[model samples]
Target: MLWRATDRRSANPLRTGLRWLLSLAFGYAGYRHLATPAPFLAITPPWVPEPALVVAATGIAEICGAIGLLVPATRTIAGGALALYALCVWPANFYHAFAHVTVGSTTLGWGYHAPRLAAQPLIVWWALWASGAVDWPFRTKARDG
Candidate 1:
């Protein structure tokens, strides 16, 4: 088997495979944004003053987090990185929350930003929990007898 039969949450190859798939999804999305940093950059405040460095660092962090999530040895680090990334990008989320954009002529409502903002903490929590950073709720019994 490609994966170990450890804790129930991570038991068997199927579950592990699913995890890798999810990680890949996040990684790819992050990569796309990294490849074209303009869309995200335009939203930042002019006084923030350092868009290039911010974009580069965030992109690298996302890419690294994605890579780390795939390997078991690096999962914990990945979780930490992801959690931090979520916190870092929060300002953009807030900007989107308050700013209004008109598409052609229709003014869309502000509900969309909720999900994006909520996603940060959710991803952070999931990454930490899924990576086994803490003792799982249903750990397998240790066979000492």
Candidate 2:
């Protein structure tokens, strides 16, 4: 087994796999946010004071959080930070959904955007759970012997 059977410190394979997948996703998304930012800028709410700066900062945070998630020592902190980051970005998702933001030939309509909005909390929870930053109802049982 990849994870230790008796060692509580070693996360189960499911969580580990989820962690890696989320890290990769965040890393790639971050790169996209920086490398080609026009789409992101288009989705930025007009109410935001400095859209470009926020985009850049969020990209940087995503990349850093991705790296942190892979390191055991930093995993929990990274998870918490990522959870907060996801929450912070929720408004942008809402803006995109409501504004019907367009990028190239594709306009993000309600059908495409509503599910993403609904999934935001799951993303945050995934980060927290995968990194073992917060596990309540899912806590494992200790050996009684």
* Tens digits of per-residue lDDT for model 1, 1-145: 3223224445436546745765776687678668887766765555566887787677777778878877776776676777777787878767746665433454346577778777877676666665555434434568311
Error of 2 at 27 (Å): 0.4
Cα-based lDDT for every prediction? 0.65, 0.84
lDDT of 2: 0.84
* Clashing pairs in model 1, backbone N/Cα/C closer than 3 A: none
> Candidate 2: which pairs clash?
none
Q: Candidate 2 — worst ten consecutive residues by lDDT sum? A: 1-10
Each prediction's TM-score versus the true structure: 0.71, 0.88
Question: Compared to the true structure, candidate 2 yields what TM-score?
Answer: 0.88
Least accurate stretch of 10 residues (summed lDDT) in model 1? 1-10
Query: Which of the numbered candidates is closest to the native, going by highest TM-score?
Result: 2
Best by lDDT: 2
